[model samples]
Target: MKWWLIIILSLSIAFLGCEKTDKPTINEDGTKDNGKLESGGKNPKSKTGVWLTDWNDAMKTADVLNRPVFVDFTGSDWCIWCQKLEEEVFGKGEFLEYAKKNLVLLKVDFPRDIEQSEELQKFNEQKMKEYEIEGFPTIVLVNSKGEEIARTGYRPGGAKEYVKHLQELLQPKE
Candidate 1:
């Protein structure tokens, strides 16, 4: 009886330790939660992920709210670090909530190993030159008049820390 109890307890501990954590559900199309945006992104239920594919579009989005612009330069595919940041940070719920309320998002994608439209490629390259972007997953925060406020990289603290960082960027320069 004692031996059986010890075996059962050991098995239980091992199983618990080895269990995989439940990530937010990835949908059939490889997006999360029916394409819902989580973690410092637009709401999935609302009209979100309205990417400013071009500088003109970015200007337009920036003009509307007159809010500071948050630009994300990423290689959506074939960038392992970008993927890690996306899964660990941007995929969280609280980040999405803060982003939806605070600022405008602009995504500039530079895909290396995949086919893309000429226009998109041109746009990305153009922006890369314009901003002098040197790496993948670089984030730039700019104000309404198109002045750069801050430049950042992927951080591991997820939504809450991002919000704090963004707030600091939004603060008036002392």
Candidate 2:
């Protein structure tokens, strides 16, 4: 009888310890219910559009819109360079506008501070392995067919320069 009680208590503690403390509830519209913007509450709604957290949904949107997928591999709560990129480029108006018209944005986050759902965590891990991502702030461009076109990381300068760099990388070779 004592052993049974001990086992139950141990199981309860293990389950409680594994539970997430800060998991954000994602709405059906892909917005977070925690009153925070997808990119750590930097921008609300922009002309560019919202950054999607789901890979399959982003791919479907890209297929329908005929736009390429821009996947941002970020560590939103931990990586300094990721935060810098988010502030300098992704959070800027110019880049938002460019993204709205040209790209389908997807954010795959591996955060040390934020608690993500188990599904999101697993998916991000799978993508990291698939893309061979070695660092935070890795940006991968994929065509509608889900083929990788280009890859880049944190760059100096603001939104406009980053936009131009993306444009150049996306341009077809002669």
Best prediction by lDDT = 2
Residue pairs in collision within model 2: none
Residue-level lDDT of model 1, residues 13-85, one tens digit each, is 9999789764566644355653323334432323233445555545555655466677888998988888877
lDDT of 2 at 119: 89
Displacement of residue 34 (Cα, Å) in model 2 is 28
Candidate 2: list runs displaced more than 4 Å: 1-48
List the candidate 1 regions with Cα displacement exceeding 4 Å: 1-50
Q: In model 1, which range of ten residues has the least summed lDDT? A: 40-49
Candidate 2 lDDT tens digits, 1-174: 999999999999999978866665675557655644443542222313789998877876776667889999999998999999999999999998899879989999999979999988998999999999999999999987779999999999999999999999999988
Q: Against the true structure, whose TM-score is highest? A: 2
Please report, in order, the local distance difference test score of every candidate based on alpha carbons. 0.71, 0.85
Sequence-dependent TM-score of model 2: 0.72
